[model samples]
Target chain A: MNSTIARLTATGLLRGWRGLLLALLPFVMLALALLVRMAFGIDPEITSGLLDTFNLDTVVPLIALIVGTGAIATEIDDGAIVYLLTKPVARGRIIVTKLLVAITVTLLFAAVPTLIAAIVVTGAAGTVTWAYTVAATVSGIVYCAVFLLLGVLSRRAVIIGLMYVMLWEMLVTGLVDGARALSIQHWGQSIAAELAPDAITASLSLPVATTLAVLVTGMAAWFATQRLRSLTLAGDS
Target chain B: MTSIHIDRVSKWFGHVVAVNDVSMTIGPGITGLLGPNGAGKTTLLSMMAGFAAPSAGTVTLDGDPTWRNEQIYRHIGMVPEREAMYDFLTGAKFVLANAELHGLSDPGAAAKAAIDTVDMQAAADRPIATYSKGMRQRMKMAAALVHRPSVLLLDEPFNGMDPRQRMHLMELLRQMGSDGRTVLFSSHILEEVEQLASHIEVMVAGRHAASGDFRAIRRLMTDRPHRYLLRSDDDRRLAAALVSDDSVVSVEVDSEEEALHVQTSDFGRFTVRLPRLAADHGIRLYDVTPADESLESVFGYLVQS
Candidate 1:
């Protein structure tokens, strides 16, 4: 990966009210978990339930989506990505570097927050908070990879990514049990179950879920590079 | 000593043709790509810069294919026509980023040299979003130059610059060209091209119309048989006096319209001779109009000839 491109990408993500606004999402999620705990008191069953439902399922994927899509879409839209593209660097290196930036942002904004929220609810019992943090990290990697590909592939990446999270993840997976095997949330759930065997559980086997997540993330990374190599500037002829 | 060779290159988007079958060899010098708007000049430059691939033929730099080639950028630097840059970064930071991207051994020194070359050191610390059009252009130049590529390609590089900035850029390009770095810039403005470029490649209607020394092509455009319709108090008398001179190749006195269509071989002498001939013949000159003065028509005449 090219460090200059990664540094530039990170600079873009961390600057402006965008960074402040995205930071707000995780804290707000953690605050809600704290409020729920104060109201109901510390019960592993209910605490894990809150962490799984609100922090992992909803918050991680959404924050990952924002960071991932923002990584390259804004530059591509304004044509500033030309600075990176016109250099003597390999296209794959640039794509991977940008993906690195997006994943780093997701780790800070989503995964770390998931751990903190888990602690506020259950106080780190049964290694449950650590398991959910690992789960959040895995989900962030998968979601960021998917959304980064979408950002490079199309101009409507944010809209399309939101639809994928809201409609396909919620509606389709909720309705069709077969769809769970292909879902990112299910993959994270499986991993989380394996990590915290006594506290958390999932529907799929460990091998199938891990393999799907790994395969999809790798394929997204590959396609993002290939698409970036063929990207052309659109302008007046 | 780098050269770009575009051999019979053509680019088309769906049904619209941008650059038709065109061929040219641009060596180490300032070569102007001259054409009016929508004449496919940018498409040609884009191909040279490796931003777009030609649909039909190939564009090569020093015998290696340009399209889909990342290594070529090591020796090539491009300033695209669009003004969009990373606006959040300061000018120095932006150029330094470009230098670092090129894997320059001493990126800081290179960025410093580049910014100083553009005479923008004083404003290098300012964010690009706060720069004026001319300053932004110079910042882009600094960035492009930071890598010290042997070849430089700029599209509409003088679009929004004031006269002072334009002259500064022209001089900078001239110095680069003199240093044996291949420099090519595209301009629709004839005067800008004429004043700076020693050689010119003219594109008209997506086709390569002419290529040679700028002054020679200018002469060709001037020397092409100019058809002028003259209306005066005495058209036949003026025609008689105009034909008496050698500069007037053929003079047609239209009795029906009461005008004279005069075709001249020597454009320079003909204009000087007109008023003198009319005055000498005791004729009142009502009007003198060049019938074909539009740029397209001039290019069309060149294409047919």
Candidate 2:
């Protein structure tokens, strides 16, 4: 991966409203954790529920969606990507560098905040705090890879990504037992359950969840690079 | 010297054909792609820059296919028509990023040279978002030129520039052409193309309309049937007198408009002889206006020709 492209992608991803949105999500999560700690006072049920329902389910995917799509989609939309595409650098390298930046941003804004929030709500760094942090990290990577591909593939990436997060991850995976096998949220939960058996439980086995997460991330990254390689200049003749 | 060979290339989008079976060789020089709006000039440039693949045939740089070939970019520096760029970065940072992407040994030095070439060093440290339209355009040129590729493709590079910027860019392009770099810029303005390019390729309605030097294009435009609305004190006598001239093809007197609609075979001869013949015959000429003088009409005539 080219460092210059990665640097540029990182700078663009964190600029203007996108940076504000990314910064705000983590701040909101941390604030909610602090509020819960003051109200509930170190209860295991409230801590686990907040980490699982609010942090893992809502905050992680949303942060991933923001940074992942923001890394490349805005450039593609505004026709600014032509400058990067015309260079001697490989398209695959560019996509990889962009994905790396997206994943890094996801980790910083999503996973690190989850770690801080878990500790904040629980009043300690225990199995529960570490469990959700690990889960958020892995899920952030997977979600970033998928959404970065979406950014390259569609102009309406954010809208489509929101549908997947709300409908598929939140609604369908929560309802259907079989859907857990294909869900990124479930994969994170399964990994979390393995780490903290008392606080978290997962429908899918850890091995299956781990394998799917790895497979999906690799496939999404590959497809994104391939899509970028064949990108056309925007606008009509 | 680098040369781009478009071998019967055609590009279509869904049901619309943007570029149709165009074949041309652009050698080391400033070759203007001249056409009116919607004439597929951008489409052809897109294919040449390797940003779009042709639906049929090939675009090659000295024999290597440009499509899907990242190596071709090492020789191509493209200034796209689109104004969008990494506006958050300073102009120096943007050009440096481009130079680094090109794997230049000293990106800072290259970026400095490019920014200087575009005469943007005073404002190079400012964020591109703060730049005016012309400044943004010049920074874009700096980014494209940072790598110093042999082939430069600019699409309407003078669109937002004032007269001074246009002249500066024209001189730079001329210098590049003389240096044996293959520079091709697209423009619809006749004077712009006439001023910068020694050779030109004209496109109209997705088809190659004409190709030659400015003088040759001028001749093709002039050689087409020249139509003029002539209002004279004695329209009947003028029409009758004009009929005897070898340059005058046909003359019809329109009584409603009170003028002679004259179609001439030779533009130069007719323009020279019209007033002389009118003075000799003592038929006072009140008005002489060329009816089909629009650029679109000239392009249409070229397409048909």
Best by DockQ: 2
Off by over 4 Å in 2: B230-245, B251-260, B272-287
Write one digit per residue (lDDT tens) for candidate 2, span B232-284: 89999999999999999999999998889999999999999998999999999
Residues A17-100, candidate 1: write the lDDT tens digits: 778878888878878888889988888778766777777767888888888988999888888887888888998898789888
Which whole-number lDDT from 0 to 100 does residue B189 have in model 2? 93
Task: Give the TM-score of each candidate.
Answer: 0.90, 0.95
Model 1 Cα shift for residue B210 (angstroms): 0.7
Residues B63-136 of candidate 1: C-alpha lDDT, one tens digit per residue: 99888888888999888878889898999999999999999999999999999999999999999999999999
Error of 2 at A8 (Å): 0.6
Per lDDT, the best of the predicted structures is 2
> What does the interface RMSD come to for each candidate?
1.2, 1.3
The DockQ value obtained for model 1 is 0.59
